[model samples]
Target: MNIDDILAAAESEAPDTRTVKVCVNPAVARKRAALLEALKQAKELDAKASTTEERLGAAPAPTTEHADRAQAELEAFDDEVLKSLITLKFTRLDGERWSNLTAANPMRVDVALDRNYGYNFDAVSKTAAMLTGVRLSDDGEELLTPEQWDRLFKRLSGHDFRLIIDAVWTLNEYAPSQHIEALVKGFGAA
Candidate 1:
């Protein structure tokens, strides 16, 4: 029985209370049935022993192993669903609207991007990239800074150019070249 029903039954049986037959609530009865089934399964797994230590010592059967595997797979499936909901990608980013993302909140922005791509830039690198007009290597293994990094950083901080640049960088990482072109063209129209 659940806590509430157990408490009610004890209260009814107390000398302080007057009661005839104390019936089990339907909801509590249903839950007790489930609990009993689980208890029976546990007992069966323990070579039909009545104690916990015996159950713990028993060798897990093939069916138990399969049940464990299925439970793990089910957990993975649920995690994937949750990740998909939390990391949905946007086809278009409004550069002006999200300019703040390039400044103080770049870390959060990169973290959000990581949820989609399974990777992200550290705060130091992301901030440096925003300040200096640096491009990542085509293979994503290197960073290039042909121009003065500090000057570029100052210029970017003054205006909102990094918003567009960051959007392009994100698109390049996730989309095909042709799609990146289409995105740029679409952004130009706005």
Candidate 2:
């Protein structure tokens, strides 16, 4: 193996990336969850109605009507949810840069002269810095500043904020085996 070829391959490697959909409003999220459950029930009902029709040679009117109504409601609510969802893309930073950023935002431990008192991860600050350049739009535009990220974290429900944080962390720390598995699946390899 030529040294120059290895150097080129390393330099040309693309960072791993992940995307997450976030619904910031707690009410909307709850409603969406309910609608999804209802939709699942409707599908089961529809399947049963079809089977009944096949077996009896007569369609069940009430079951079909209920399933149709449930499907319509789900479709309308899905449109609303789509309008409110914010899609965030997270890209991994290269090793040296990632190391530097984490080093600069160390989790501090509080200690007395005699013994250890406590430790603070300062998660908000650390996460904000780690995600600064890593977070982007679907179109590859930078999404938010640190201040904006802080404000978003404050405004979002814990569940919603955690979704974004998880995406960012996963992209940065995902295992090579996972990547290979994904590629294998893409190629339909057993």
Using lDDT as the measure, the top candidate is 2
Kindly give the stretch of ten consecutive residues in candidate 1 with the minimal lDDT sum: 15-24
TM-score of 1: 0.21
List candidate 2 segments past 4 Å from native.
Answer: 37-62, 108-142, 174-190
lDDT string for model 1 (102-183, tens) is 3444344336754544434334324433333223333542333535434433433312333433544554333445666798
Q: Write down the lDDT that model 2 would get.
A: 0.63
- Model 2, 1-190: lDDT tens digits are 7999998998898766666666756677788789878878887887887788778977544456656787788778877776667666666766665555556654454434112212222352236334643444556666587686666667677777767666655554445548778999999995
TM-score of each: 0.21, 0.62
